[model samples]
Target chain A: MKPWWIVVRKEVLESLRDRRTLLSALVMAPLFGPLMFSFSMQTMLKRGLDEQDKPLQVAVMGKEHAPNLVHWLESQGLEDVPAPKDVASIPAAVRDAKPRLVLVIGPDYGKRFRAAKAAGVKVYVDSSDQDSQRDFRRLDQLLQNYSSQTSALRLAARGVDPGIAQPVMLDEIDVSTPASRAQSLLAILSYFLLFSTLIGGMYVAIDATAGERERGSLEPLVSLPVSREALVAGKFVATMAFSGVSLVLTLASFAISLRFVPLESIGMSANLGPKVLTGVFLSLLPFVPLAAALLTLVASFARSFREAQSWMTGALLVPTLPIMVAAMTGMKPTALLMAVPSLSQHFLIARLLRDEAVPLTDGLLSAGGSLLLTGVLLVFVVRLWRREKLLG
Target chain B: MIHVTGLAKRFGTVEAVRDVSFTAPDGRITGLLGPNGAGKSTTLRLLYGALTPDRGEARVDGLLAGPEHTEARRQLGVLPHGAGLYPHLTARENIRYFGELHGMSGATLEKRIDELVAMLELGEAANRKTQGFSQGQKVKVGIARALVHSPRNLILDEPTNGLDVMAIRSLREVLRGLRAAGHCILFSSHVMQEVAALCDDVVIIAGGRVIASGTPEQLREQAGTTTLEDAFVKLLGSETAEVQS
Candidate 1:
């Protein structure tokens, strides 16, 4: 047999024969991406729809100051949650967590709006938690709508047309088509894709290295006609094959899930259009090989089955840092920025989400650079294989 | 078949094998006798190319041993201290695995495996995984795997270190037969009787260097001793001489 062919055949056969390792390699990889995406998107989507539909659940602490404000909030589907007897008693209710939000009225009452000196309503919110922040935001929006409508009516009551009193108004007509939302949704998908590529071949890589050592069969293999570089290369190629399969399956799963999803329910007219999917997928292609090679090199150094697995899982989760940054606040993409691991892909996904044009050069650089790094990693693994201290 | 010259190996600051030199000629059983940590295994590893020496060389059939000298390795067989067979694979599979690595294939591999199974008397345990095999069975399998490839030079490191008395005897018989078959056999051991009974030539190592080398009787006569153990102690100059030096 050709020397590398011997290695490749042995690796593929052994990985398949070992039921646990085979299943872990074949199953967990494809399972993780779809399961994670479906559950996460489902949760976020459900929570979003629920929030818009949930009767705002406004808690009015100072109802006596302006009865009109309370009535206005009711019209917006906000139900007031009665508070403790007095404003001094409000702190205990917040401490006991009886209410998500606490809106206290100042002693000025209706007189402040008449004077316009202190038209401010005190909003005491629990910013310490997720539910609190979300609840506070909805309440804040409800109060703004009330205040703006009240100001307009107040002007009209004074014989001044509200349009005349206000010379200008802020208008934000988002040009982001339905295709854009679909593209932004791809941000999380990019993370999933990136994570899938790095972790998919984890089992195969670990099996090819630590499994061979643990079986006490590595030294003999090392003492073969083949060079250590060839052995590492063969194993690397097998691992990359496993990773590529996962990337493809994950992308396919996303395509299927997005097609059936009701985007309009969330008030997004986004069509996970073919163009956006193609853009995001094309941008991620170069990373797949690099990620597989990098993880394979890392897995090759692990001393045991458990160590290899842990290293693989760690590689997948580490990308979450960049994913979170872009998902939380998508800063503008720059030339140097595309050089970052997931930055360019993320911005690309975001632009496609917002239905904006992306420079073709960014996608090429991201994939090409990733492929180059993979090559360097392959060289490093070859050298490591020659070192005796790492056999385990 | 094996040659060694100044085969010194060191780990960091400590010298594991220092200025060690010897040859186990073809068709002979050469005994390597040493106390614990006396660089016996280190020397064997250097000989088999498992480790690189800080200085000197180990040549099998005129080819130098090192990480890249795999082609040179096909001529040798090794039973590393405990038989480096995978516990998860059956004894048969382990032997076949190593055989394949040594370039045995197809009919040659199957026929050789059968011959080893019969020779090692592992018919019952051959198909059963080595994970729960008794130490004696493991030793037997280790021996079978080392000799199965029909390597001209056989290097065993403390082959009977932990084998039971019966297992030791069985292994001795196998070694005696191999010696008679004219395979160049070099093995290390601390047991003097094993060396006295099995080796035609014995080399005594102390503090990473050879202290005495000769036939067991020659060394015993040179030290005015009746037994190989006594000859080893006298020629190596016991603890007192070591302390004075």
Candidate 2:
């Protein structure tokens, strides 16, 4: 066997024996991402389902002025309640989580309806509240229906055709598939997947580099006949191997856990078939080497394992940038984006999940870019090792 | 043989080693005797290719020793200061790791490990992990790892700094046996009795410079003292006196 492979085997074997490294890097890191995703999805879905089953309560201030509207709301599964004494009290009630929807009907509502004029109905809701926001939309749709029905009755009383009031009939056709809509709502999926690939090898990389230096064995090992380049290559390969296993475990965990999420109830479909899983795995594979090399290079500068861990934690923010920016800007994946590293992999995973046909050229471009970066990073680490202060 | 000629190294503005030169010939044990901060560690580091010299060279068997000189490094085994064994690995595994790096593997590496384990009297500790090992046990493991590849030359920095008296006596015996086997061994120490007892030739260094080099008896005669320790003190005292003059 080559000297480098020997070094790699020793490092991997040593890390595997360390219970701390194995627990965090292999078992916990992979499981955390998928578990976090499923937990969050399940919570949000549960909230939405609960909101659907619960009755909506509308607080009306001038209930006497709009008996018909109140009656109409009651027929649509909305309960009527007397509003608080003052409009300002409505915000306090909402803050206390008392009522999510409130309706304010002025005394002039009766006069306006008798005179056939537009009457103002003020709806007070905490738009910041997610549940209140859903209920408010439902209440708004009900009021619109009541207005049209009342207008038609007035027209009938005047012996005029009710169709004269409606000049145009409009309908909306949504062409988006459940998977495509799910892609945006579940943007977190790609983030967690990429994060898993980046973090899975972190403990191994630090253990091989900074941990070796701390143990005082690095100088003896370096004094051997093997070249520094081979030493670095061996360590890098080990880290990448650990990361690949972590990625596989993470994807598998997500695949199994996602089945129980009830995504169809929310108009989102995520199919973790063998094909999609394979595609996501392949798309993330090219970046594993780059992540390992970059992490190892940065960690090599640290004087101790704890110091290296802190720097690695700070470095993790870099990978999260692409996803954060994409979310903030609602970035559409362009051809140029397909050539970027983390963004490209994220884009590919999303596309595969959405059932979009990702071209072979896109995959090749991303892979080539990642490999090129890995080569550069590996050379940089080798050079850093050659420096005298690295022993310190 | 190991030759370090006109070797000089500087750390920032401080001259850590200046004009250090010595030779440890085959079939002999050479001692580098000096007090703390006397550049003994720096000189050994240069000899083992752990540091580059700012001036001159270190030659192992006529080949220049430096980072890129793998051939010379293959001919040398180094146990640097405070060298540590992997606590998680057995003593045998630690020795085999270095052997593999030197391209010795399979049955040959195993045989070498067994021989070194017996020579160091580490039979009981050979199969166990090195964690929580005593100072003597740790040194035994380090020595085994250094000699795993059977290099022509060996450089050890303070091999007996923290060892017990019994451990030191056993280690001295091992060095004597290696000398009889025609291995060139160079080690650094400040203990007068240890140097007087084991070294065939001694190089005394102070302030990063080699002030004197000779057999222990010769050094005693040069200082007109019967004891090697007094002789070494007198030699250092004269050097300072001459610098003042």
Candidate 3:
């Protein structure tokens, strides 16, 4: 075997036997993302389904003044509950979320209806309250339907066509498929994958560099006939192996866990079947070297194992920045954007999950960009390893 | 044989090694004796190619000893100060790792590891991880690892710093066995008795400069002292007194 390969094999064997490395690389990093993702996604899907299936209840004042309106609301699935005795406390009650929402029909509502004038109704709701806002939307839609129905009746009684009231009706056609609709939520999946990739190689990188130095084995190791470049290459390859394994395990876990989430109930689906999973893994394959090199480079600067661990923890946040920016700006993958490492992988992953074909140029740019940056970082790491101060 | 000629090193404003030169010939043990901070480690580091000297060169078997010279390093085995083993690796595995790195593998590497285990009397501990090994066992493993490659020259920097009495005795026996096999052994120490007992030739350094060089008896005669320890103290005392004046 070559010198670098020998070094790589030793490092891999040593790290594999280490319990801390195994726990982080095999267990914690791979499971944390999928478990948290699936649990939260299931909760979100359940809440959405419940909101649509559950009845909307509202407290009503002056129900007698607008008995017809109340009747229309009940037909539209709004349950009418008795209002509080004091009308002045309605805002406080809404703010306190006692009834969640309150609807008040003014005393003049009946007179206005008889006079064919517009009757005013007040909806008391705290807009800042998320659940109250959802209930308020259902109640508002019911009220609007009642008003339109009454207007149509008035128009028909006057021997005029009620159709004239609605001009230029919007016929909305949804063009998004379930997979495409799910892309927004699954955009976070790329971040998790990238994060776990960095985490997978973290301890290995620190162990090979800072941990070796701290243990005082580095002096003997470096004093061997092997070149510093070979030693560093070996360490980098071992780290990449760990990160790659972690990336694949995380992808598989996500694929299996997403099945239990009721994405279909929310008009979305996770396209994480075998084919998509393989595609995502391939798309993210080039990122392993980049993450390994990045972690190794940062760890080589640390003087001790504890210092390297803290620095690696900070390095874990690097992949998230690009993903966060892409999500916030709604950035689409262009030729230039594809040349950015983590961002390109995010865009490719989102595309793969949406069952869209990744452009060949985009794929090449992403892999090439990540590998080129890896080369640059490897140069820095090798140089750092060659320095006499590396023994520290 | 190992030869170092006029080596000088500077760490920022501190001249860790102002000037150093020494040679340890084959079939003999040479001790680089000095007080702490006397540049013994720095000199060994330069000789082992871990550091570059500012004004001199270290040569092993006629080849320049530096980071760029892999062939020179191939002929040298170095046991550095406070050497540590990988806690997750067994004693045999630790020895085999260095042997493999030196381009030895297969049955040869395994045989060498077995030999080291028996020579050091590692026994069952050779198959177990080094994490909870005693300090003596750890040092034996370190020495075994350094010798696995069977280099012509060996360098040890403060190898007996933390060893107990028995460990030190066993370590001395190991060095004596290597010397009998015609290997050039160079080691550094601040202990006067250790040098007087083990070294065939002694080079005394104080303030990064070689103050005296001879056998223990010769050094005692040169310092006009009855004992080697008294000679060492007198030589260092005069060096400090000269600096003060």
Candidate 4:
């Protein structure tokens, strides 16, 4: 076998025995993203389904004054509970309420209704509370519906057309497909995937360069007849192997975990079945080499294992920056955007999740761009390895 | 044979190895004896091509030795000062790694490893992880790794730095066996007793320069001293005096 292959084999064998390497590459890094994703998705889905299915409950004061309004609210899925005795404490009562909401009817409400005059009511709620806002909005809609009904009846009684109240209806039409709508949530999946890819090879990259030097084995290894290029190439390939395995495992975990999340209830389905998983893995495959090369290059400059580890933490953020930017700006992918490595992969992943056809040129550009950078980084790493100061 | 001529290397302004030259012939043991910070390790590094010389050349078996000369390196086995083994790897695996890197594999490599284990008396340690190995055991594994390819020449920089008396004795025996096998052996040390006990030729260096070179008996005779230690001190003292003057 060639010298580079030997180095690769040795590195792989050594790293496999190391518990830290195996934990990060196989267990921790790959599982972290998928598990967190599934848990959060389940929580959001549960919250959404609960909001729609459960009836809104409100503490209503002066129930007798607006009995008709109370009946209408009950018909509109608002349950009335007994209100506080003192009207002065309504704010504190709302704050103490389960859903933190209270409805109060004025003493003149019935008189005003009988006289066909404007009536008054109050809804006390804490806008600062996030969980109560949904209920508040539902209660507000019910009151608006009751007011419109009363107005329409008055108009009909006067022989005026009630349809004049709504001259122009604003019917909202959401054109986003279910898959495309899911893209917003699934954008995070790309970030996790890219993050796992870098983390997978992190220990091995550090171990191969800084760790070896610290262990004092580097001097003997470099003193051998083997070329520095072969050694570096071997280490790089080993790091890529770990990163690739991590990517595949992360994809598989996401595919499996996403099944338990009720995305359908939220009108957002994750396209992470076997086929999409395979496609995503392929789209991300090109990034493994780049991740490995980038990590190894950064680690090569580090003087010790601890220093390498600290630098690598910063390096892990390099590929994620483009993804974060793309997600924030909701950047649309153009042909030219494919030339940016991590951002291009993000676009491809987004397209795949949306079930949109990925252009062959975009795929080529993304893979080409990543591999080109890998090549450049590998050259720089090899040159760094050849320097005499590298022994330090 | 290993030959070094006018080797000079400096780290910024400090000349770590200044005008130094010596030769280690085949079938003989040559010790580069020096005091602490006396350019011993730097000289060995230059010889092994880990560092290039600023003003000279190192030749291993008639081939110029530098990072570019793989052929010359192929002829040498080096055990750098304080060299370490992969703690996660067993002693045998560590030796096999170097053997394979030297392009040796299959039965030939395994058999050589077996011989080394027996020769070094590594015993069960050969198959055990080196993480908790004693200092002596680590040194043994390091030497075995260097000797895995069985190169014609060997260079060890302070191989006995942290070894116990027994470990040092065994290490000396290993070097003597290599010399008997017609291998050119060159090692550096700050200990005069070690060189006097093992070396056939001594190259004494002080402050990055070779102050004297001869057989232990000849060095003592030249310095008019009864013991090799006194000769070393006398020569080093004279060199220091001359520098001060």
lDDT of 3 by residue, A200-267 (tens): 99999999999999999999887899999999999999999999999989988998899998898878
Supply the TM-score for candidate 4: 0.90
Which of the two candidates, 1 or 3, achieves a greater lDDT against the reference? 3
Q: Write the per-residue lDDT of candidate 3 for residues B94-168, one digit (tens) a residue.
A: 999899899999998999889989998899999999999888898889889989988999999988888999989
Best candidate per DockQ, number? 4
RMSD of 4: 3.1
- What is candidate 1's TM-score against the reference? 0.88
User: What are the clashing pairs of model 4?
Assistant: none
- Residue B60: error of model 4 in Å? 1.8
Model 4, stretches more than 4 Å misplaced?
A57-75, A79-129, A139-168
Chain A TM-score relative to the true structure, per candidate: 0.85, 0.92, 0.91, 0.86
Clash-forming residue pairs, model 1: A178-A269, A178-A270, A178-A271, A180-A353, A183-A353, A184-A353
DockQ of 3: 0.77
TM values, all candidates: 0.88, 0.94, 0.93, 0.90
C-alpha lDDT of candidate 1 relative to the true structure = 0.76
The residue pairs in collision within model 2 are none
lDDT of 4 at B98: 94
Per prediction, fnat is: 0.24, 0.79, 0.79, 0.85
Give the residue spans of candidate 3 off by over 4 A.
Answer: A61-67, A80-96, A104-124, A147-168
lDDT (Cα, tens digit) per residue for candidate 2, span B124-230: 78999888788888888898899998988888889997999999999899889888999999999988888999999999999899999999989999999999999
User: Alpha carbon lDDT of residue A88, candidate 2?
Assistant: 77
